[model samples]
Target chain A: MSLREACECISDGDVLAIGGLTIHRKPMSMLHELIRLGRRGLSLLVFGGGPDVDLLIASGMVGSLDAAYVGFEILGFAPNFRSAVERGEIKFTEHTEYSIMAGLQANLLNAEFIPSRLLLGTDVLKSLGYKTFKSPLTGEALVAYPRITPDVALLHVQRCDEYGNAKVDGVLAIDLLLAKSSRRVILTSEKIVSAGEVAGSPFEVNLPSTFVDMVVESPLGAHPTSCYPYYTYDLWHMISYLEYCRRGMVNDYLRKYVAGVESFESYLDLVGEDALSRIMI
Target chain B: MAPWTTDELMIVCMAREVENGDIMAQGLTTPMAIIAYYLAKATHAPEASIMQLAGNIMVYFDEPPQASILYNEYRAMEHAVHIFGQNEVYETIFKRADSIVEFFRPGQIDKFGNTNNSTVKAGRTVRLPGGFGIPDASPLYKKTLIYCPRHERRVFVERVDHVGGLGLNLGGATSGGREIRIISELGVFRVDGRSGGMRLMSLHPGVDVEDVLSNTGFELSIPENIPETPPPTSVDLRLIREKIDPLNIRRLEFLSGDDRLEALQKILDEELRIWRSSNVNRPKAQQML
Candidate 1:
């Protein structure tokens, strides 16, 4: 199916949690389609930072962020997130990656709250306006992070069968949990394999087809970011993007990459063969 | 002998801070700490376990990970047993682990050892990355070491624009012997265990007292006799350069230029290809196990 068809799975103002840890397997193809379609007033749910979050803010897609962190990790400050925060353009529901995971766990378990010691000595509780529940047995204070259910989950996997059984190679970070916890899941894959092929190595099949709603083939989908076993992250591209970010060229960048290109295919053409091949060694 | 860069000194100093039987955690964008964690493991603290670059808990590698925590050499993960999911890993780091220490890098740091990845400019207006996982799991670590490559007034401030962490707690201190230390190219700064204020613990060689004072954003504690940070021994340098990180990829964390990064990217690609071919996930002879 087309990128547009896959993106139709999400609606504007929906709380969308995108996958990947910093510069890992994010669904760039789907995100590009969302940008082209001009989706607005979104609330983002994510654990770590990367170009995806910056892209959302640069295009004015995000109104509020239920975020743990949102930088390019080692690469540096996310330009749009930084600029928006500096200018007071966005609202943030503060979290650490732990809280985000705990919150997601609550949603998965259908629980009211999850107790934790994550916010012990920090202002995350007061500012975020959450509370802690004492253990009945021990009377020990425990922070209770509220449950969160993203309206949709967007994730990129190494492989997915026709029916949407995703094969996650290497570290199965939070992609498995994110898919299970969300109301709807849209997976963009590097290769679309037959369910038989996936079934052959059933142990590696992380998320059963029952969990996935849409499966779109997106070769080299996790560009700029890494998809383990395929290629390392294009560090040059990240640095170049971060340079644009540092100089506050969010619009110029969006104009060139996200908005300027009509689709992910056209965007890939602009990315050039040189950049991708370099990361492939 | 080739002269060592400030990063080399910082890595060595950071390595010495490690103790045996310690489980240390470092985040992304923290190559120096990652190397130091392994350097400790390779040297005196052999019992030390590092959180591998890809967030694998209690994993060890014979060589430097081609990158950092995210892309640890999976082949070297022969010791890889007992996978910890993201939640379990942080839970282990925070609540369960004993003798835990974590290394972190914040965009901005303050007098109380409080670091901020939140924002800048003092009004909650300027946003840096949200606090990652620092606030929740930080209090659990027995010691926290901060790494800031650049040291100046803006880097070190009187008050962080936002408190991403409650470093030493100027008042209402906790009972745990929570220690916080910082290592930069210029000097080593340690928290006054009692006052929770920062003190100039040691100056790197050739760095003057005036230079350290001038660069700090707030007043720093200058003792009557401040020592110099000890340099890495010749044997230690050999272990770091040859055995631990042969590619010198560690320098890319700070000193990487376009030519170097381009080269590093290519190396990483090849590394991944190799890891894929010999991946443990695939069906194989299975006798290696």
Candidate 2:
């Protein structure tokens, strides 16, 4: 499927689960397409966040965020998301990274909530309304992290087969859970291979075809963030992104790199081959 | 040798926390924790295993790799002993809760050692990077060590604005131990499991007790006689400077503003020079795995 066509499946107010850890293999191409499509009222579900979540928040499409983190690491706070929350622009429900994972684990098990020892004595219980239930088996009190089932999950990987079997280099993060827990899964990849090739090395296939709904082959799909081995994160671009967000020029960034371009190739052209080459490992 | 910086001193303190055959989980953007684990594995805890949370690779390298923002994971993966998925990372932590010791750099920590890497101002005013796995895992770890690069009233609060991680009380009937030690520029503090209060462990050299008291937002439990925190030995200094982290990337945690950016660029430049000289871009593999 094409990027635009895959994005068209998403509707406004959809619960969207974003794949990848902070500053790693985020689905940048799909996010750009979603921006171009102008989808709004999105409830973003992510375990770890970075510029992608900030950019989506800046796009004014996000209605609420259920996340563990959203930051630029050593650089500073994620400007757009931080300012938006500070100004009461968006409803943000924070969860610890474990809660996010546990929620997904519950969903995978078809359970209402998973009992956990975490979140006890922490303010997350009062803030998020996670109830403390006594386990029937042991009579021990445990925090019940509710299941998280997103409407759609967007992921980017190093490679995928047309049959929807995919492989990722480096960290998988929560992408696998996002794929399994979400109702619909849309994948973007740097390369598309034949089924025979993928089957020959079946052990390498981390994501099976059964879970994938659509696969779009888009090279440089994880630009700015890393796809590892293939390329490292473009730190210079991130530095510029932080500056643009700090100066409240996100629209200009969108124009120059995302919406201004006709396609992903054009976006890459604007980023320049030399710039991309510098990040390639 | 030159006088050791506080960052190096803290790294040595943190490294001392890890025992032999321990599993230290390294989280994202933690250059100091990364080096501390490497230092431990290279020195006393040669059997210590490092679980890279960001890269999802388990390793026990003979020598630590250079710490770079861009290449930390890639370089770690090169020496991968066991490559696993994200779910396994959590499962490993849970299964080995009694043997794991993790380090965190909380945005705000309170008297009871409750941390807040989430939003500040009672989760309303200033937004901080949400606590990744600290809250959940801290309760289950054998020991939780928090290192604050700059110690001040802002960080050492009477009560944190939000509780992203539980402190001294290892809640529930988990097999994990009750141990939370905090190291700051001023000194070291340990939270009492019974009272759930912060107590002065030791003051770093050249730092007065008054300095620590004034900087802390809450009243600290001080003993009758307080000894100075031992300075880094010459061997520890040598290992950190000459072997484990020659680029001094661990200092990044202590830096902020323009100074941080400048330091980061210098490290990146040095990394790029080394990377370019050694790595030959293998032709894109046909199988794509």
Highest-scoring model, TM-score: 2
Per-candidate TM equals 0.86, 0.96
Deviation of model 2 at B258, angstroms: 1.6
TM-score of chain A for each candidate? Answer: 0.95, 0.97
Model 1 segments beyond 4 Å from truth?
A132-142, A243-256, A260-262, B54-58, B63-83, B122-125, B170-175, B192-196, B222-224, B242-289
**Residue B156, candidate 2: C-alpha displacement in angstroms:** 0.7
DockQ for candidate 1: 0.37
> Model 2, residue B62: what's the lDDT?
76
Any runs in candidate 2 off by more than 4 Å, and if so which?
B122-124, B169-177, B194-196, B279-289
The single-chain TM-score for chain B of candidate 1 is: 0.82
Candidate 1 lDDT at A276 equals 70
What docking class should model 2 receive? Answer: medium
